[model samples]
Target: MRESFYRYLMTKRDPNGIDEISHFANAAFFDQAFPKHSDDYHEISHYLELNATYLPSMSVFDEAWQGYLEEVI
Candidate 1:
């Protein structure tokens, strides 16, 4: 799924030529990638923390999460 998403971002087939995968444009894709289920908020948080810890030298997860929250509002 991530690979497909990267391809989507790398491709320039969209009308606007923006390939970052906006939330609305890729709702189904994100829903599949990060499903809303289970009873483990802390577990998920820990998992994300682990990923953020090593995923990038400069983390943008916080900014991205803020943007996602703003979108929800």
Candidate 2:
């Protein structure tokens, strides 16, 4: 799953082409990647932490999370 997600991340792009990442876009990706886990925040957090290597970096993932939250809340 982590490998699949790593491949998936490579395909992600921000439509606006500003930050190279879009929280709204990634939120959609999350749902697609982990449909069952989407409702479970703890699972999501754990998954990200465990698969942190699949991501560019913890900081990048964090920026995405924060960006998502900012737009959401």
Candidate 3:
């Protein structure tokens, strides 16, 4: 699930490369937080809220979560 979310984020990367900072930062956070496994949306959302400082906004994660759901479902 973590990798899927990361991949979803990558799909949103700006073509001109202006959003890479947030993109990579979120990826790194996901890597550290869920290195092995993570599939629960509430668990991931809560974790992000606890570490909100590391993200641009909850909407960014929400968008990725939506994308992840579309891909898997």
Candidate 4:
């Protein structure tokens, strides 16, 4: 859920606005961001599922992971 929310913000909102999103995007924030009757989460989940086969590189659980460099002693 957290990852999905991050993706949503990065895609729809500003990519650098994650910190703000974390502060404002709770249950109430979700209710406000999406329409009251719209099933946005469900739709996003469904979109992932639907495109899972088409894009193996980008699946529902496939995150664009980056590893931090470790400092040598």
Residues 1-73, candidate 1, lDDT per residue (tens digit)?
1222223322322445343334223432333443233224354345446543333422333443344444433
The TM-score, computed over Cα atoms with residue i paired to residue i, of candidate 3 is: 0.59
User: In order, what lDDT does every prediction score?
Assistant: 0.35, 0.47, 0.60, 0.33
Q: Top model by lDDT, which number?
A: 3
Ordering by TM-score = 3, 2, 1, 4
| Cα lDDT, model 3, residue 40 | 66
Q: How many backbone clashes does candidate 4 have?
A: 0
Q: How close is candidate 4 to the true structure, as a TM-score?
A: 0.23
lDDT of 2 by residue, 1-73 (tens): 2223223343455665545345434544554454332433356557766754445555665565554454443
lDDT of 4 at 73: 10
Q: Distance from true position, residue 33, model 2, in Å?
A: 4.9
Instruction: Please list all clashing residue pairs in model 3, or write none if there are none.
Output: none
Which residue ranges in model 1 land beyond 4 Å of their true spot? 1-44, 52-54
Candidate 1, position 13, lDDT: 29
Candidate number with greatest TM-score: 3
TM-score of each: 0.33, 0.43, 0.59, 0.23
Q: What tens-digit string does per-residue lDDT give for candidate 4 at 11-42?
A: 33343445432322232234333332322455
Q: RMSD per prediction, one decimal?
A: 9.4, 8.2, 4.1, 11.6
